[model samples]
Structures are given as C-alpha cells and as structure tokens.
Target: MWPIGRSFSSQNLFLCLVICQVVVCMLFVIYRNTQSLEHRLAILTSRWAAREDGFDFPEGPWNVTDSDVVRCSDLINGRFPSEAAINRTIDAIRETVIKDYEFIELTRDCTKFAWERGYYNKPITKEELDFPLAYTILMYRSVHQVEQLLRTIYRPQNIYCIHIDSKSPPLVHIGMERISRCFDNVFIASNLENVYWGTINIVKAERHCQKDLLNRTDVSNWKYLINLTGQEFPLKTNLEIVQILKEFKGQNDIRTLAQPVEEWTYYRHVLEGDTIRQTTLLKTEPPPDKVPVHKGPFFSALARQFVEFLQSDIADKWLEWFNDTKNADESFTQTLASYPNAPGGPGPIGSKAIISRDIVWSSERLRERRPCYGKFVRRVCVHSWRDLVRVSKSIRLFANKFHVEYDGLVLQCLEEAIHNKTHNPPMLTFHFIDDFSSSE
Candidate 1:
C-alpha cells in the first residue's frame, strides 16, 4: 500500500478502470447489461417523453414503476411498513379506486398508444425473437387489469388471442376491442362463450382461442402457447422467460399424475350464471377411448404441435365427451397430453409438477392456516399486498389471480419491481435499485 501511493506512472497512461456488479435478482430476473450513459438517460426520460430515439435502442420495454407512481417503492422492496405508511397506502388506494384515478383510456391508434405506453418496438434479443409465443388469453371483465397484463407480457414477436365472455356487458367488449386494435399481434377470438364455473363453456372458451391462434398465419412461427386469465400476471421478464423456455428445449409445462376425483368426471355439474353453486345434475359418460385423465390447472404453456392435436378428429371426440363433465377445462388439456396417440412431443416425459404456471390455492393451505390477506375467488387466492413480499422470491414464471378491486398495491408493487429490473437494473444492496450497469 505504501509503495503504490508514491507512483501514478504507467507505460501507456491510457488505461482506465470502471466498476460494475453482477447483480442477480431472485429466480428468473434478467436485466440488460452495460448501457451507455446517453442510453441510460434516454430510459430515464422515456417516462413522459416516450420518443422514438429510446425505442430504437432496444433492451426491454420502457415502463413506469407503478410503486413510485403510487409512493410504495420503499415499503415493498423488503422494508417493513410503518403503520402510518400502511394507512397512507390504504387511503391513497381507496381514493384512487373510488375515483378510478389509475385507469387510462385506450384508443385505436397503435402508433400513439404504443408510444404512450412505451412498448418495445424491436426484439430485445435474437434468442427471444426467434422463440415467439402465442397466448390464449381468457378475460371476462376488468379491461384495465387486462390491459396491464397485456402490456407486461406483450412483444411484437408473439400473437395473442383474447376471448371475452359473451355474457359480459357491452362496455367490457368495447374496452377489450379498443385495446386489441392498438396491436396488430392481438385479436379477439371469433368464437366467444358464455362461460360459467364448472361448466362446458369454460372449456369451450379456451378451445376457441387455441383454434384461433392456430389459424393465424401472421404469427404462425410461434413455438409455445401459454394460456392466461385477465387476473393472472407474469412474474418474469420476456428476456428471462425466453431463457427458461429455451432450456426446456421442447417439453411442455404442465402437472399430471394426480389422483382421480371421480365426482368431477362421473357426474354432470353446471354452475349457474354468475353464481357460485352448481344446481344442475345429470349422468356423465366415461372418458372417450378409455384415455388416462389427469387433474391440473386449465392454464398451461403448450407446444404448437399439441395444439394441432387438439384440433384433430381424435381430440374432438374427447371434447364432445368432456362437455358434460364438471370443470372439464381443468382436465381437458392435461388428459390430451397423457393420451396414447396425442402430440407425444409435449408430454409423458416432463415432471408432474407445474413449474410454468403458478397459483396459490388458499384452500390447500387451510391446515397451516397461512394468512391469505387477499380474497379467495372460486377457492383461488386473489393476491394482496401481503403476498408481494413472498412472491418476490418465487421460482415460478407467471402468477395467477390478481384483482385490482381486491388490492392494487400488490399489483403496482409487482409491476414496478419488474419495471425497475427491466430498465434500471441491479444494485449490490439487498434493497431495490433505480440504477443499472453490466456486461453481456
């Protein structure tokens, strides 16, 4: 130390040193590496400026951190909430929700809307672009929530097939249509359904979207198909998703090998319109061709080949049989994967546990009495602020069941978390950072 302090001389005198960190956030977080100062400044300015200069230099979509916008960034990024802060958040959320302050009106102009929302115009990476995705999004209500979900998952390379329940009001359809018009890659399925819980229409709605996605020649190169409801949101960034999915190579992400619930298939059950209980009963037929039926969430990430199989004569027979079964959506795709002559490429090889689609069924955790601060919808938890801290470390890619009416703070926090990670990347501290630096 003493010797070095006396001399500042070097042979070239041109060498310079810079500091950087390999900041890794939990589970599948990916941030762009080593940006130029001008580029960083452009990102900082994109919030209001939303200019083409920023969109030209692609890394990820520009996002406004909803937490900072709502004043909850500190409390959610691992800091314990003070009582006053909690009360303040509560008051702000109540005020905003009652007045509907957070909602943004969407228009049909793709250029203006995209610039206003700061969608990534180009592919972030060659890897992500080549592995385009197709989404079968089932959304019945809440246009704002659906828009946020679309913004989070949207990429020009992917195609989205949105199915709005035919039972919803005209405003819901109008709102969805407005949003859909703003993106060429997104569209409403021609065949929509009057979906009801535990009813045939539930499965019919999703099948319709798969059929639509497959028919689209524009985004036909899409390799994977992920299904989602308006309430579900992605936990990982697009870049990270591409990485994880590429690792999968070709295997589908779904759960199987579940014990038979005879009541589900043996009896016909129908849920009344907008009602929680089933009032109808009739004899149900056994699965066609004696195929092995498996139980899992209807929401899944599938391969294109499997979706093709779903449209064939063989799958039509199964669909016809399942029309009378209770909650057939939960079993339809899973059963098809286990079928003897099904796609064969998507399954019978992957793990039984569902790693891609994540959901916390509050009903299953009753023995431990884990606190579900969020309200339960059809036995699934609608995420609340308390869930934010816990989900930050979840290994799963996408999480299900978020209701803005339930508690938007958690959604805001999550959106901000992903936003900050996408634009302003890692910091060495355990806390969140509004700064980024790296090398690819």
Candidate 2:
C-alpha cells in the first residue's frame, strides 16, 4: 500500500499536467488572434492614412472597421513608408526558412490586404471603349518594384506578360509567380532569357514575351503592344493612355532614324556562350542582302498589324541576317520599320510613324547623346525625381527609367498626380499632332 502523502503528491502532478496543456492551447489561440488583428490593423492604417493625406481612394468594397479607423490614425500618416520599414515589418512574421506553403499564404494574404485597402481598385469604368488592348512585356529583377508598377498600371481590359530574367535569384522567381497568380490577366512568360545589354539576347527576350502574348487564345483582342523594362513608369492613366493611342489612328509608335549604321553595330562579333560579358570581334562583313540599316532605341508602342508582320517569313529572314550583328536590338526593329516590303511599313509617314519614347539625352539631340539624368549604366538612364518632375510637363504617355528603391518619392508623387488627374489635364482634351511631335 502507498503512503497517503505520496498518493496526494502523484495526484497533484497529474493536475499540473492538465493545467499546462490548457494554458498552452489558450496561448496558441491568443497568438493566432493577435496575428489576424495585426494584419487587419495594417490594412486599415494604410487606407486611413491615404484618406487623411487628402489622397483619393478608389471606389470599392473596402473592409474597414470603426475601431480600426480610430486606432489607425495614431499609427499611420500620409507619407509612404520606406522599403526598409516595410521589410522590417514583414520579417517579423516571416520565417527565416521560407516554405512554399507559407510563402503562398503570405502572398495571398498580402495581396488581399492591399486590395482591401484600395490599392488594386479600378478607378475607371469598363465599357464598349474603342481603346486598343495594351499588351505589356514587363522584364523585372526587383519583385517589389515590379509589384508597384503592376498595381499602378493595372486595367481589367489589358493583358500583361511578365518575364523574369533567368539569372535572377530564386526569391524573385517565386515572388513573381505569386504576384502573377493574383490576376487572371497577368501571366509569366513560358521562356526566360538570360539578358545582357547590347546583346542579341536582349532583343530575343522581348521577342519571347511577344510570341507568348501573341499565342494566347485572346490575342485577337489586343491591338497594341508596349514593351517596358521594370524601371519604366506610366506618366498617364489608363484613360489618358487610351485617349493618346486613339490619336495614333492605327499608326505604329516606333522610333527609327535613316542614319548610317555605326561600324561597331555592323561589325561581326561573337558572344561568349549566351552572355554578353565576353565578346570577341570577328572579321567585319557587309550586312546580309545589303539591307539598309536604320537606327533606333528599343522602347516602342507597336500596332498589332506591325507585330504580326514581325512573326512572318520575311521577318524571319531579317532576324537571321542580324543574328551575327552587334547591338542588334538597336537596329533590328528600326530596319524592319523602314523596310518597304514589310506590312504597315513607315513609307511616306517617315518619322511621324515613330513615337516610341521620350528620352532625355545629355546633348539634347536625337543622335550622339547619353542620358542627361540619373547614373548611366550601359548607356541607359536610371531617372531620378528631379528628372521625373522635368519630364512630367512633356506630352509623352510613358517615361523610361524609374527605380523605386532609389527614389520612391517620385513614384509616390506621380501615383498621386495620376490618380488625382493633376498632371497635364489638357491631355484628355484631345490635343493635336504638334503637341506630341517634339523630339526627346
């Protein structure tokens, strides 16, 4: 028989175990509730802050609570928080070892939160508009910046094809996939290219996206194609863009110049493997078929008919001819645009047919100049806020080279301007050809 004191001690131990299990379960429930509350608070705060700052929130079914609004005012202000601050907040909840399920859940939840706060709301109505369907090719390295750009230019009527560089980190690929899944109109390109500046592969990457977009069952709906790097930003809203594109009246907006091809451009060069990092100059040879070489930058807003022509047998011949040429991207499209046999060729329209981009150069000339603003890497401009301010006054529908991490303020201000319709209200009034003809 056990002693009475020992019996009581054993009973007490069992009671303690029961109490501990209950406490642990209770704590877990509390933790989960707290997480849910925190997420709700973050969204509410973002929305309330936008409203308090005199910013116009898009009309939608936003999930906001009276208690949340009162609490949010204390936490959030009008200014956009820096990227670092956002990262810090996310890191607290995100595990160091990112599991796929966790990542997906996080992505879905964050996207939902942003939507609830009015970030993804449509500011315009969908109607029987004659606007050309916009086909966008977005090549990106920075996932966050790409997300911002996607959100800023999103329209239900448009189709977006995103291409992430093959060499980008794994996280970038995952993030892009998650973001792409959020919208039915958005998708990742089937083929990813390892891109290099001044290399043929750069042009190939664009072509890959174009082909992917063209192959879609709904390709017939898209009437215009705009190729943009991750760094580019829209200076006009969807309504304004549609209005400006309508002015083109089926004309292509590509830049082409009837200038002699530079010796470096035509010279035979061999790229080391698939990369442009190492190239060996081969013996110079005349361009195939003695095709007259025209020069232009890569940025373009092309008509569907012109893009269709590019997929034809004749374009295939030109592609083979320029396959060995240096800096092919700079000359390939220009040559095709000027080729008389090609459909929708420039013909008598000449430079008027080309209105691809507004580039600010150091010399302020069409040729023989580098970007005037931002640090030039590989001759392309990484534009700053000051440059954005100066270019904001121009009639260009889109502007090149904005790095959000470098200057988030510019993008934030531009977003505000676009949403508020403060910048260039006259653009909506249907101004004439002269307003848009100025060289960048």
Candidate 3:
C-alpha cells in the first residue's frame, strides 16, 4: 500500500500515457482514411496483380507492401502537385524536358543537388553500409532517366561505374561526367566502347567498367556487382536490396540455361567500326576446353569473387570465343555463372528473382500477354504510369525499361514510394528467400 497522494499520482500518469496512445492511433487512422474514394479504390485494386496470359513468360503472384500502397495512393490522391493537375499534364511535366547541365555545373555542389533533386546521401541501415554493392551501368540515351535513376540509388557507401556509349551525344557524356565529379565513388569507364547492339562491343563496355570498379581500392570490400541499363528504375530501396542479396548467401544471382554455342555464334558477323553485318552463315566453334555453354538475361547480381573469376585465363578464352558472336552480351555473365571452376557459381539456372531486375518481352502470338501499360519498344515492354502499382509491389530489386520521357508520373510515383519506405519502414517486411527451392 502507498500514500493516497502518491497512489493517485501514479494512476494519473498511467491514464495520461493511455490517452496519448489513443490520440496517436486516432490521428493515424484519420490521416490514412482521409484520401478520396478513387484513391481508396486504387489501393484496393492493387491487391490483384495484372493477369499473365497463356504461352507467355509466366510468373507467380506479386507481393504488395502496405508501405508502397500508401505512397501509390498519395500519388493518385492529389497530395502532390503533379496529381493536382490532369493526368496527361502531370506526366508531361518531365516527359519532354531535359535537365540543364550548364546550371548544374555552375554550383557543382552535392549538398545543393541532393536538396534540389532529392538524392539519398546517407545509408539507411548499417547492413547496407557494411555490405556495399558495386554497379556497372550502361547508358546511351535518356538524360533525365539516367540522372534520376542514379539519384534514387546513390549511396555514399557503394561504388558506381557508368559506361556512356562512345557514340552518344556529347551532352550525355558531359552531364554524366559533371554528375560523377560530385562523387568520388561514381566514375566514367577508363575506356569507353562504341557500343553496338547485338555485338561484342556491348560486352566490352561492361568489361571495361567491371575492370575499373574491381581495381578501385576505395570500395574493394563491395560484396556484389549489379548490372543495370539507364532506362531501368529500382523497385526496392537500397536497404531492401541489401536485405535480398544477403538471402543469396554466397551464390551469384545469375540466370542461365544450357544452350548450343552455335545458336549465338552461328553467323560470321563483320564489324566495320561499330556496324555489324553478317556475311556468311558459318557457325563458330564451341567454348574452349569443352567448358559448358549457357544463355539467359544480360543483367544480374554477381558476387565479387565471380567477377574475379572473369579475369582468369580460361574466362579470357571464353570471352574471346564470343567476340564474333551475335548478342554475346546476353550470354557472357550468365554462362560464366554456372561454370564449375567459377567461384560462387551455383549450378546452372541461377536466374530466379534474387531480387534483381526484370525485362518483359511479349511474343507476337501472345500479344496481349502480361499487360504492359507502357508501349512495347522493339519487343520488350517499356513501363508507364499505369504500372506504378505493380512495379512498386514487386519483390524484385528493380524493373527495366521505364521510359520516363513517355510517362514521367511513373517515375515520380516510384520516387515517392522509395522516399516513404526509406524514411519509415513498413510494420511488416516481406520475408525474402535465401534461394529458389520447392517453395518458390
């Protein structure tokens, strides 16, 4: 038993804490529920994923984060200035406009750039800082997209190696170089290759950057190397990416399938400078020393050790064999991922999520396959605003080919989502897998 005044004061304190908690809960509910009906519907509709048609590239159900749903809702709820206007006008804000590099270079201040353009300067988690990843990015076009993608993924702990195609506009190189000057970790490749599509130059460009990044002593402790194209955008925040890569446990997240070497190296491709012309249908010999041949996606998350393996003698012979091959970019990293002698090599077929990027290709026969709200460029789908809900919910680290010039709202909304997740992590995070298995 206590004195009457003391007991009363203790009860009063407990009651005040309960009142404070209740008020906080009520405020949260009101804030979340105040959005318009249409916004609520957008949130509700995101539960069911876009349908995947028959005979197309199949995938399982999408995983939606509650945190992403709120951000998507806010984009549609007119919380931001973009959504206050009509949809077309909102998206058009960034579609046709290019960044003014002259103005950017005037100050050349990182603090100003980060405040103005919203780059995440500090690491979100100790896990991300301790396990810094390296990036080898390919860029030829879309100045705004490249800059925004870099802004979103930029971190002090990580290193970035960008390879601007030698044939690209001078402004492209200038813009990238000026931006790179602001950061010690990001740089242009020592040797820029005149990248030609469906040729070995594409592979060489990546090799140049890989070598550059590997040689850097400042960030030599980086755990993995993630390859990206300028057009792609990250679906996950940097911290989330760090979390998923840890799931791979030491294995590289490369996708590969055993294929005949003749398939890609079948024709005698003549390269006069950057132009490629097939003169004769003569198949090249298989990989040297009977090393296995496999093919899959060009982009992947490779362990640092696997990158070291690539500099070895046998790997040199393997790369040389593909020098004259068509679309060798698609086979190089993937084929090397499954080699028995390769360090961190998981047996063939490593392309499972591992939370890396994705490319959507729709076949002509199944034209209405997985709905790409964005128009199809060549054969691959370039994502647009309508895909925001889907893209944000994906467990993958990033999704490729977002044409910001077409629908800038998608990128804006993704930015909002990442900003929200970075500042306030979700109450429950998706349990990422260690590797593909019976359950996946």
* lDDT (10s digit) by residue, model 2, range 1-440: 32235587787877777899999999999888755532322211101123333333333332323331221111222222344543443343232333433445656776674585345665553321445465555564667667667777777668888888888878778877887777767889888888766677777787777887788875347777888878777765666566556556667677776564555465565667664432356536565567778877778877777888878776677777767666788787777877666655652233443444556544445532333446564555666543443444445666777666565545555665666552222212223344444332
* Winning candidate number (TM-score): 3
Task: Please list all clashing residue pairs in model 1, or write none if there are none.
Answer: 34-438
> Scored by Cα lDDT, where does model 2 land?
0.60
Give the range where candidate 3 is weakest over 10 consecutive residues by summed lDDT. 40-49
True-structure Cα RMSD, model 1: 10.6
| Model 2 vs truth, CA RMSD | 18.5
TM-score for each predicted model, relative to the true structure:
0.75, 0.69, 0.78
Model 1: lowest-lDDT 10 consecutive positions: 431-440
Full candidate order by lDDT, most accurate first: 3, 1, 2
Model 3 C-alpha lDDT per residue in residues 99-205, reported as the tens digit of each score: 64653573378668766776654436666788899999999986678888988998888999999999898888888888888778999999998888889888889
Q: Give the runs in model 3 whose Cα sits over 4 Å from its true position.
A: 1-87, 103-107, 120-123, 260-263, 272-275, 281-286, 346-354, 364-369, 427-431, 434-440
Error of 2 at 326 (Å): 1.9
